[model samples]
Target: MTITFVHLESVHHKLSKASHKADPFSDARESGLDIRYATISDAFPLDHDRDLHREKYWTTLLQIFPSYVDEFVRKLIRSDPQSLHFLVADTVYVWPTAIARKYNLINVSFFTSPAHVFSLLYHLDLLKERGHFLRKDDAVDIDYVPGVGSMRIRDLMASLSKRSDITGNTLFKAFEEVKKADFILHNTVEELESDTLSALNKYQPNYAVGPINLSEASSVAVSRSLHAEVDITKWLGSKPAGSVLYVSFGSVVQTSKEVIGEIAHGLRLSEVNFIWVARAHLTSSGDSNVLPDGFVEEVGDRGLIVPWCDQISVLSNPAVGVFFDALWVEFGGREHVVRRSDDLFPSDLRSADGQEVGGW
Candidate 1:
């Protein structure tokens, strides 16, 4: 089937440019989709020194999204539109999906997080109704989440659970919106999340066409929002091949100073060669001091910390053998966080084929 892919850049000027540069749609043109990019004119302009004050962030999203959806629908209407089979959109914004509904087109909810997380989020309201969510106090004794297994209440994704006045209301509205769609789309594969996917299918028709990393990156001229001085390639080359731990947590989640200090300290103690992507701006917010005193001095040349670098290129290098999410580093204090193969691989980790290495 022929598909036309359209991207709406709704962030402020800086972020939009970065996203367009790192867009993973250039390969679609070869596959036969008429790809398009639409920049939201009044989007919040994000910069190094600027703060997307929570209020302004949501306001801009509500503002520019309607215009973006309208423009996209206009293009669709002018083209072989009715021939279009489905309207798949991110779970956040509902305007485009609403437009699809008005046009009588099939609408599917596209969730970009792990399928288990998606399932937990989709059923969040049910949890609240059943009293599994304790709203009186943020601390509640919850044993498990719907599709996702035992996780601490604090780890419960903020988007699905209780949020502030504006954010909470917005998330619920979006959650309710997804239920109206024909089905939910996840950027995950059945092999990786078979049980979760099976459980989720009871709600809607689920199609898993992902590792989603398999998609080629955008060919459009792009830029990065992070600093440019770090030479990540050369540094990676200095490390023994496949000996570097690549640490990063995309743009959305920010680590606290305490967590950052703990991680830096642990890496030093662990004596593992690592490349860490630390967004300087995240540290700059609210606190003048973000890292532990003597963090750089303690670790010395063993760790390479940078504001940001081309992640795709860094991962592609043979020097990077293991992937470590900075969020996961919180679990580093535990005994079974990571082990080595033959002894270097994480001992408690199971092999992809299901062979037991170590049980957590």
Candidate 2:
């Protein structure tokens, strides 16, 4: 089967393509597969920066996304009426199922996040009916969500746990439509999330074939980073094995200045050799320096902070030890120390919900 990776073109990806920096699709070309590629306009101007005006950007995109998908699919079918087509989409988009049905294509909903998160989103109505949606009490246990077993309400992604905004509402709507998908694909491990996947499968044809980001070219390092990456090889290599802590909340996940300050203070107080991906758009307030005052001075040579780096390379590094998506909230300041890297896997590597997060 021919698989064409269709990218909803973004300004950052456009820049990356022009410069030939961090080609996310290079490995695909090198794989010698029947795979093809295409880019559809996200209906945003070339100069538009989504990070600068995130709310407006997403709100506008969500409003017009269905129309864009409809146009793209319509054109795709017109281009090749003879060839059979299967439409696979990220679960975040609301129009995939309808678009697929319109074009007589098999629709597949792919959930890239953890299956546990998917379970919560899939059962949004259950959460609402049970007074769990936007509940004030974070301490309440949420065991009723199918396959999720027992997890606290607060453990959910802030978007799921907290009050709903336009973006959140749109995301919830997308998940609601995902139920109509012909098939559901999760980028997760079946062994790890077997229960969750099994529960989801009862509703639809669900499959757990993942760590998909790794691709067939596992040895070849590739990054789809929109930001310029800092080469931390020399600095990271200097650190002893299992001594450095790697901290990043990912490209799009934003936190407040207060959370940033707390994490910074905790890092400084911990004094562990570390590399922190302090992306330029890490905060919504647009504060360039999210680090606390004297944070750099206090940490000095012990910490190497960067805008971004090739995450796969960093994780593969033997010198690197702990990886923290969340901050030092789990590990108290100065008191708790990460001694052995082995001690941090499977057990310590848990979501806020206390579920063991499977790694790539």
Candidate 3:
């Protein structure tokens, strides 16, 4: 079967001219996989700083993205109508179901997060019925969501805990569209989230087959990273086991200067040797002054702060103490939570083979 990976390039994945010139699927070609790759324009300039104007950026995207999807689908089907059988897309897009219907394609929605999170968003009506949608009371218990245990609304995802913001509303609407999808695929492990996945399958065909990033590619290396990656393997090898902390807020989520300062200060106080991926555009202001004043000099050689690094490589290193990013599950580590800072190191961490490691 031929698989075409159509990447919709947005601010999160603004392509550099060099990257645009490079063949992104050379590995797939070398591996003899019948895969095709294409990059679709998100109608934003390559140099546009979306973070500097986030609200306007997202609002405009919502207005224009659907038309682009429609045109793309129309042209592709006209080119070879019978060749296309399935429309697989990220669940965040609000137009997949409609476009699939227009083309008579079987729509499959892919939710990158765990099934538990997907279940919460999929049951948006249930939240509204239980007074949890747009809920401001963070302390209230959210016990009614199917397959999810009782947790405070405070523990709920920020998108649901806070008042419906532009992005939150987009996600809510996207999930609503996702319900109409012919199939739902989750990036979660069934063994780990059996109950949650089982619950979701009752409404639609839900499949658990992810944390796919950890999977080894067949025969060739194909990199899809949007940022330049620095190698920290040598530096990490020098640190003692269970002595370093891996700090990152992920690629797209931007925080305020205040939050960056707080984390920086906490790292200094804790005296934990660390590697922090302070990616470009990490702050809403898009300024380079993300770390606190004199932070580098104060921490000196104890910390390695770079614009980006190979995260899975860093996490796999034996010297790293704990994984602090809430975005990805811990692969190896004794769980440790710093309650004062409300940081959690996930417990019962396992490697790809399901073997437990002593530390991250």
Backbone clashes for every candidate come to 11, 0, 0
When 2 and 3 are scored with TM-score, the better candidate is 3
Which digits, one per residue and each the tens of the lDDT, describe model 3 over residues 115-209?
88888788888888877766556468888888888876555666664345677878878988998999988888889999998888899999987
lDDT by residue for model 1 over 1-360, one digit each (tens)?
A: 655555434343444454544444445555556665444444544342333365556665666657766766766677775576678788877565677767777888888877876776678766777666533333554545555676555455543344554565666678778878888778898888988888877878877777665545564323444344356888887877667777776665554565566556556655667788776445425464566788777777768877677777887888776666734532222222332112323434344577642231
**How does each model score on TM-score?**
0.74, 0.86, 0.88
Sort by TM-score, top down from the best? 3, 2, 1
Where model 2 places Cα greater than 4 Å from the true spot, the runs are 11-27, 218-223, 326-360
Winner on TM-score between 1 and 3 is 3
Q: Which 10-residue window in model 2 sums to the lowest lDDT?
A: 330-339
Pairs clashing within candidate 2:
none
Which sections of candidate 3 miss by over 4 Å? 9-21, 162-164, 326-339, 342-360
Whose TM-score is greatest here? 3
Error of 3 at 313 (Å): 0.6
Tell me model 1's lDDT, rounded to 2 decimals. 0.62
Candidate 2, TM-score vs. the true structure? 0.86
In order, what lDDT does every prediction score? 0.62, 0.74, 0.74
- The residue-by-residue lDDT of candidate 2 on 263-308, one tens digit each, is 6766765657888899877887888988888788888888999887
